[model samples]
Structure formats: structure tokens, C-alpha cells
Target: MVKHIWDSDRAAKLPKGVEELVYRSNLIGSDRTVCNWGGGNTSMKTTEKDFRGREIEVMWVKGSGSDLATMKTHNFTGLKLDDIRPLIKRDQMPDEEMVDYLSHCMIDSKHPRPSIETLLHAFLPYKHVDHTHPDAIISICCADNGKQIAEDIYGNRFVWVPYVRPGFTLSKMIAEGVANNPHAELVLMEKHGLVTWGETSETCYQKTISIIQEAEQYVNDRINQHEVFGGKRYQPLPEDKRKQILAGIMPVIRGAVSEEKKMILSYDDHDDVLEFVNSVQAPALSQIGAACPDHLVHTKRVPLYIDWNPETQDVHKLADLIKSGVETFTSEYQAYFTRNQQDGDQIFESAPRVILIPGIGMVNTGKSYAMSKVSGALYRRAIAVMKGATALGQFVSLHENESYHVEYWPLELYKLTLAPPEAEFSRKVALITGGAGGIG
Candidate 1:
């Protein structure tokens, strides 16, 4: 496993209260072996010294939307420790209301809001908390008999919490569990993630690596490699054919973005995408599953399968096919919503974010082509992982009821609104050697 070390000298130069920040940043950076693509967060707590020498202990957690691998000093925010304590004590806070707390209770008052999970981090018993959706861990958790697998891999060192939306409720559960077993160092959130903490950041970070590596090895030994497969390849579409596909998809993509934002559309056109479009497994795109429950907001539950090719110079035919696919996807979504309705509330948008074309590449619906590409790229990754896990055994994610709770959860939507207009890529490039493997 890889061991990561942060800039100890640079961390020491920061204000006295930043010990947790230094620890968390390095721990996250080191544990990138499992999580990549900005999938996790970490936090630490200490008393902030005021100019008058009065001390106020605050939670310095990863800021919303920041990548853990390259997190910097400023990405950590000081949240009022007192405010979070009471909410956790109550063990309940409405989803949207929790987001409001994060937005309103700022230490500097003018700085960016803390992460949405800041409350969860603050409520934990440890001075430092690390959370990640490691690929290896998630892969195992998404399979049948995951509990047994986890027990065999992590043993009694970790505690498992069933899938819950990440917020006050999840924090409450963790708080209660910790109260029962105060010695627990790890919390394995079923179908969600792995949480590790320590007195110092390095201990928590190294433990994260060790756990994921163990899981990866266990999976390798148990699962047959031949059952795992990459996507299939397809023949290239001619110019007119490609243009027809774009014409059918562009309108849907345009309607999704706000009018004020400049929008551009692009396609994967990569070897993998092209191959998958024509492969025998193409029909599996719309199978009954999601990459992860959280991903439903961006990619939707499943993609629309476009199978009928536009006839030679038949514009109306292309339009008909597109409309048909849209209608089918909408019908399926309505069915899902009806079948999974918790209350009498109405459903959200019926449109799918990605459209899969047989014998061609896929189109991602987004405000801009870049954003769409990110969504599609993430979708492909999820599909690959799901397919890989199925090779070992039956693949599963959180149930639809659980998926719906998060899909309709107000905090998630609010978090989306709080994000900057366009997705921002990190300026720093992080590469960790010999850290953990496959959770992130």
C-alpha cells in the first residue's frame, strides 16, 4: 500500500487551529488509490484562537465541490461547532433545512459555505474524519451477499450502516452507533462509502489504504476474471448518418440548459463508445439498475436506446425515431415513479440525461458539451464497474425506495444550485504512489 505525507512544514506555518486541515488534506491525497474524480471528503476539528485569545473549536471540513486529492488550505472552512452539535443532538433535520444551515452558519460569514456533509463530520466522535466512495469497497457492497463479504474482509474493525442520504439522518445514525461502540475506527456505509478516522490524519489515511487493498485482493481471488468484459466495438457512422443522429439529439440537449448559458454539444466518438454502441451488450444499457443512487440526478436512472437508423435522406424518419425513443423513456420513467411513489407527490423531469444509439456513440444531455461529457464519462465508469461486479456475482445497488429518497431529496438539489455556473476542474494534478487501491 502507498503511504502519503503532506507538507508538514507548510501545515505548521498555518494558524494553530489548522492541524486537522493539514491532516485531512494529506490523508485524502494519499488515499486516491481507491477514489478518483472528486468522490470523497475529509475533516478535522480544533479550537480556533481569536485575536483576544479566546478559543472556539470549529470543524474544518472539505468545502463543497472540492476534490480531496488536490485539496488545499483554503478549501477547508471553519464551521461553528456549536451550531452542528445541537442539530446532531436532535438527530433530525429536514434535508433542505440542513443545506440552509451550511449556507448560513459560516465562521468568516463571507467565505464559501462548508461541505453539505459538514454536519455529519462534526457529529462524529473523532477529531478527524475521512469519507470516500472507494471503487473496491463499493463494488463489493453493490454485490449480493455484500454483508458477508464485508465481514470477511474488514471483520469487526468496522461498523456497517445501511444506505441513508448523507445529512442529519446519516449523522444521527453514526452518532448512535458510536455511542454503542466507541472503539470503532471505521464505518462502512452500505452501498454508500467507507468512513475512517484517527487521532492524527496519517493513521486514518493509511488505514483507508489498507482496507481497500484487502478488499481488492479478496475480490480478485474470489471472482473469475473471464466474466468481466469491457464494452463492445461498433462500425463508424457515415457523415450523413452522424449528422442525422446529432440533429435528433441536439434539441433535447439545448432544452436542458438555461438560455443565458452558452451551450456547445459534443459526442464521445471514442473507440470505446463506438464499440459499445454496436456490441451485443448494447441492449443492457437500459437494464434495471443505476450506477449509484447519487448518480441518478445527473445521468438519470437509465439512458434512452436509439436503435432505428435514419433512412437514406429521410429527415422525418429520424425525427420520428427520436420522438419515439423519448416517449418510451418517458413512459418508463413514469412507470418507475408510479411504482416507487412514497407519497402522493408528482414526479420531476421525465427526460433522460444520456441517449444511447445503436451502432454509434452516445449523446449526453447537459447545459454545455463539457458538462455533458463529464456526466457521460461518469456514467460509463459506473457501467463498467457494475458490469465488472456482475461477473463476480449478482450486482445490486440501493433499492428504488432508497434511490428515490436521495433522488428527490432537497439537499442534493440545493447542493446543485449552490455550485458555480459551470463545472470547474482542479488546477492541481495529484498522483499518489503506493496508497490504497479502488475505493475512490
Candidate 2:
């Protein structure tokens, strides 16, 4: 996490509300680049008093689709400050309507709708707000020991809240939590991510960076330095065996790819491909999950670990592992869900999308090769971050029940829901699997 500040060229000419826009947008966009895809938000509040002589009557906030890493002033949609203040004080509101109401309060008349979490940003009693699905922070939260670790690392400086749907209900939960822990400088939402704020844009941005850096450093110190496990050192295979191995993998993956994504199948797998595959951490890399709530649908709670069997040159054996991995995972997931579930909640799938085989490295087996591949890549980054988070102290994340609530929440269900009527068949497509080099 970098404590972002306005560049000298821009800060030198701070244009009132523009300063908040520049700093807050950059702060959020930067974090979004590393971990989230359509998942995070940020904001800044300006009271009517702050603009004493000016006609500007609203607070600026991040807009939907704006990447914090490269957000410009136009990326911020402004909202009436007075309108937001009163809503946060209210007891309830529908989630979807909240965005519409917030939109009506936009500070900039021509800008697109602001981020859906705008109200949640408003609920925070600070001038600047920052949130992200940081890979390192989230990896720790997904682990079995997440809660204890978080308590050990953050201590009193942070307030930890259970995972909630990211809208009115979530905002209400946070507002109440903040009221209870008024002194807390930071808030950590379990199975989600971190939130930090301050009196100024710089203060809020710097605080967020500093806190994340602290967690990163803490994790780094505890990383296992040795490359070899027990007496084994990972080594590459002979060129022919490698080619043969690739050949087998290519066919299965090609068989699973859709026509629109067929171009991806033609990509060649060579030593460079092998090298990339080999670089993935296998045995100890099983800890990564979604950096926040949204990522869970893609990566799941844990990755499957498989080791090479010398007697098994058969690809069917490998396929069996993939199938069995899903069964085993589903069983374990159900067990975890059943043990932690609240009233009326149902358990989800036991299938595994990403698998890590010791010597063979990582294999993605999702609905398509690309989707599965992305999941694998995500896990690698997450694991690296978790290793770093450990040095900060023990990692803490959402309790099991909290994770269940978010995973099964109606909002999340909307995403998991299938296409309606005949659209379901259209949503499905052909699957191609294999490399141009005659291996998959």
C-alpha cells in the first residue's frame, strides 16, 4: 500500500474540491489495480461551511467504472452533502434506491452515477475515505487463523466488523460499529477488506498506506525462507517429458474452451510456459482466497493441492483428481458451512476451480481455461501477500459465520444466479482446449 499524495504539479495548484478528488481517486484507483475488478470504492466529504464563498454545494466521490489508479477529476461524481448527512442518520433504506438517491445529490451535474457505496462512504465521519480489496490483507482473512491474526496485528487501532452485503445494510452495520468504537482510526470488514479515513485527503491516504505497509512488513518477516521442503528441491523435467506433459494438458483444456475464446487455445506452451508454471508456489500456496467479498465466487475459500505420482502417466488419473478435488472441497465447504451457518441458510458447491500439483505447478480448471487461469494467478498473488501479512502479527479476518452470511447473501446471489429462460443456453458456449505447440 502506497500512501498516495497529490503530485507537486497538481498540489501546487490545489483547486478547492479538486484536491480531494485527485487524492481520493488516485488512492482508490491504485488499490483497485492490484486486487479488485468491479469491486471497491472511495470518497471525500465537504461541508457547506468548507465552501464559504463558493456556489459548490456538494461533496465529490468516486464514480462507477473509475479505476482509482488513473482517476481524473471527471471520475468523481459529486453529491449534495446535506442530503447524505441526513440519510446516514436515518434508520433504513432499500439498497438499490440508495444509489439513485445518492445520484440525485451528485456534485457534478454531468458526471455519471457515483459508486454504489457512496452512502457507506458518507456514513463515515471523516473528510476523506479509502477502501480496497488488497490481496495481502484479504489472504490473511481467508485463512483458518484469520481472526486471531488480525487481533494480534491491528489491536486497538482498528475496528473489525463482520462481513455484510455492501450497501445500505452494510453501511448501517458500519455506522453503528463506528459509533461504538469512536476512537478507532481504521475499520476492517472481515471476508472483505480495510477502510481508513482522516480530516484531510493526505491524512486519509497516508494512514491507509501506512497501515497496509505495516501489515505487509509483518507478513514478510514470518515468510518461510527455505525453498526446499524437507529434502526435496523442485526441479524441471526433461524436454521430451515436458512436451509430452504439455501435450496431455493441452487436449483437456482445449476440449473445455469456448469458440469465442478459441484464440487462447492456440497460444503455445514452451519452456517459458513451463518456467512460469514452475514459478508457482505449490505446497504452501494454498492459503489465498478472494481479496474481498466479490472475489469469492471466482476463487472460492481454498485451493486444491495435488502432488505428482510417478506411477501415473495417465491423464484420466489427473482428471480423477480434479473431479475428486471438487467432491472433497464441496464436502469440506459444506462442513464448514454447516458448522458456522445461521438460521435458514443453505450450503453451496463443493467443486474446485484451481488446483496446485507439487511438481507440475498450477492448473486452472474453471468453466473455461482463462477463467481458471486467472483464478490461479489470483491465488499466487494472494499467497505472497499473506506471507507478508504474517510478519505484521497474526492475521485476523471475518469469523466463519460472517463469511457464510456474505457468501450466501441475496446481493451475492444475484451474481451467482443463472441467466433467465432461454438466455441460459445462449450464455453457454463452445470450449476449446490445446496449445498450438501440440500440448495443453
Candidate 3:
């Protein structure tokens, strides 16, 4: 179960309103079980003075590209609530037009762009709102019988929203759902995440924590009752042997996938990772696609799984297998792009972000060490989600077309452009041969 870590004394030090919202956001985001890095958003509706010194209702939301755990006052974008609230009344709004419309709603032109789900926060009739992709909740959300499980867990306390890509339409649907169900205390987006709100920040934060704990307990209870991931099929090799194998194979796998852009590779052999990769269901489950939409941008639609026999195959054989697997993955990815491409849509890199080796571990690739680590962490969460969902029933991933759309979504892609330009040695690894006197 996810522990409730709210500290009243800590929260009391901060001002009430936006600062409290940031504190609440950080608390929720601090736990990977509650939300993955940059996977969730929070908002607070407060009255603020405009340029004319006249107070107007403003919605302060987590900005685009900002992570909840590390964000501050400047990381939030403030917008006039009166301006964006009216958007909820529209019958339909296109994605492009919605972006344009939201830019005009900013309370200060200098503030960063509001989150893509700003409208969802604005439309809800609450002062504090939180939308998080909690692993416990997502486990239930991604199951084939997700809706029925959710109902069993929470009954009608939370409103169940069918899968809808996050945008104007989804925002509107959530608002209508809340409006229609006055008794509902929370909103659960199918195959997505959980949404909670309150008149006070503490109330809001506590509600989010309590609900997740309930779901976590439910999943834990059920998971303990069954053989997870259909019980492990292969045993992990000794630690020394695993490391030796990784040292030999990392470069070959890295070189194979880095044809277009150089990449840094990070390896993981945690008990969970080893358990999943060595499981009977690893190949079928890993190929199904991402467990959540937020994971798409970081981990890609699906990870490439190398079908090599660890005991029978040498590093040379594994290298050849990596080449063959990557080729197949690239071809499949290109076909996916072709099938889902729109007029203005451009394809992202065809290389897979994650690779799983049976009886070995998982390898995550990115432009830098930090990014590679993040990819590994997120995929680990995906593994956890898959385990829980499958333990409950068959795990269901996001649709292929939906995965393509998210991978190419302009708004999602825009976050990548927000980072500062990489340094000269950005993607290059360096070694200091002589630590005591390197210059000598």
C-alpha cells in the first residue's frame, strides 16, 4: 500500500494557495508508485491581481515539460479562469485550435505554456485538482475487466471515463461526467490515471493518497493470491555472470540501435526486472505496448525483446540476435508510422527506447545517462503495471494507433524542445584514467 506522507508541519511553512499546491504536487510526485516522472499534473484555482490591479480568478497549473517533484512557482503557468472556463461549453474543439486558444488565456504572457490538461483542471468545479497515473490505479485501469474491477473497488464513488486521448474533448467529457454525477468523489480515466479534487489542498492531497492506498491494497491482496507473470520460467544467472554478459553485449546492442543518433545504454537487473524478463509471459506482454499514455514519450510504444537463449547463446550469438531484433523492430515501427501518419505528422526516431533480454535483464537507451536511467525507471513501472494487471486478469495496453498519435503528438513533442542545448560532450562518455593526478 502507498503510505500517506503528508506532513502538516511542512505544509504549514508554505503559504496557502499556489505554494501549498506545489507542496502537495511534490509529495504526490515524490513517490514513483503514485506518478512516474513528468507523468502527472496538479492545479490550484486562486484569485490574483491582473495588470490593472483588479483581482481575477486565475488557474495555476503545472506547465508543459515540468515534473511535479521538482517544479516551483515559476514552473506553473497561470491563466485567467474566466477565459478558459468558457471553452468547456463548446461542443467540440480541434487540437490545433485549442492550443491557439489556450495561449491567449495565459494570465501573464511571460509565463510558460500551461499543461495540456489545463482545461481539465479549469473546467472542474474545485479549487485544488490532481491528475496522476498511479501504478495501483493503472493496474486496475489497464486490465481487460478494468471497469468491473474499479466498480468492485470503489463502487460509484469515482466516475469511470472510457479511453479518450487527452485534449479538449477529454477535458469536456470529464467536466460533463463530474457535472452529471454530483456524488462522485473522483474521476478515473480508462487506461490512463486518477483525478481527484477538493476545496482545500490538504483535503485534495489526502484524498489522492487514500484512494491510491485502497487500490494498492486491493491489487496487493489479489497479486499475492496468484502466481505473478505466470510464475518465472527462467532463473537468473549469477550476478558475476550477468554483469560479464552485459559488459560484452551492451556495445553491440548500442551500436545496432544508434545508427541514426548516438545513445547511452543503461542496464537493469533488479529482482522485479529479472523476474519479469525470465517469466513465461515476458515476450507476449512486452510487445503489447505501453501500459499508459505518459510512458509512450519516454519508453516508446513498445520495447524490443531479444529472444536469445542465455545458457546456449554466447555474446557473439547474442550480438547477432540483437541485430536481427532491431531490424525487425525498426521495420515494424516504420510500418506503424506509415499506417498512422497524418498530413503534417513527421516520424520520430525508429530506434526502440527499451530492450528486454530473457534470463538476463532490461537495457534502456537514451541520449544521456540521466535520460537512459529515466527510461529504465519508467519501464520498470510499466513492468509493475503489467504484473498487477495480468495478476488480476489479462493486461490490456493502449491501442497501436493511439500509441502512434501520442508518439507524434505535437504538444508532447514540444516538451523535448524546451530543454537547453546539449553541451559538447552531451552524449559522449568520458573516463578519467588517473584520478589522483589526471593531468600527470
Best by TM-score: 3
lDDT of 1 by residue, 198-281 (tens): 777656666777777787777766545643333344456775777676776567544443233434445666665665566655
Quote the positional error of residue 173 for candidate 3 in Å. Answer: 0.8
Error at 218, model 2, angstroms: 2.0
Candidate 3 has its poorest 10 consecutive residues by lDDT at 431-440
Stretches of candidate 3 exceeding 4 Å from the true structure: 432-440
Kindly list the per-residue Cα lDDT of model 2 for residues 70-151, writing each as its tens digit: 7688877778777777886667788667866876776556886776577778777777787776665664555456666777
Number of colliding residue pairs in model 1: 15
TM per candidate:
0.74, 0.67, 0.97
For model 2, the superposed segments whose C-alpha errors exceed 4 Å read 1-6, 13-24, 31-35, 47-57, 107-110, 143-155, 224-244, 257-291, 300-316, 319-355, 364-377, 385-440
Query: Root-mean-square deviation of each candidate, in angstroms?
Result: 9.3, 7.0, 1.3
Compared with the true structure, all predictions reach lDDT values of: 0.66, 0.60, 0.89
Error of 1 at 57 (Å): 1.5
Comparing 1 and 3 by TM-score, which wins? 3
Q: How accurate locally is residue 333 in candidate 3, as Cα lDDT from 0 to 100?
A: 87
lDDT assessment of candidate 3: 0.89
The number of the candidate with the highest lDDT is 3
* Deviation of model 3 at 234, angstroms: 0.6
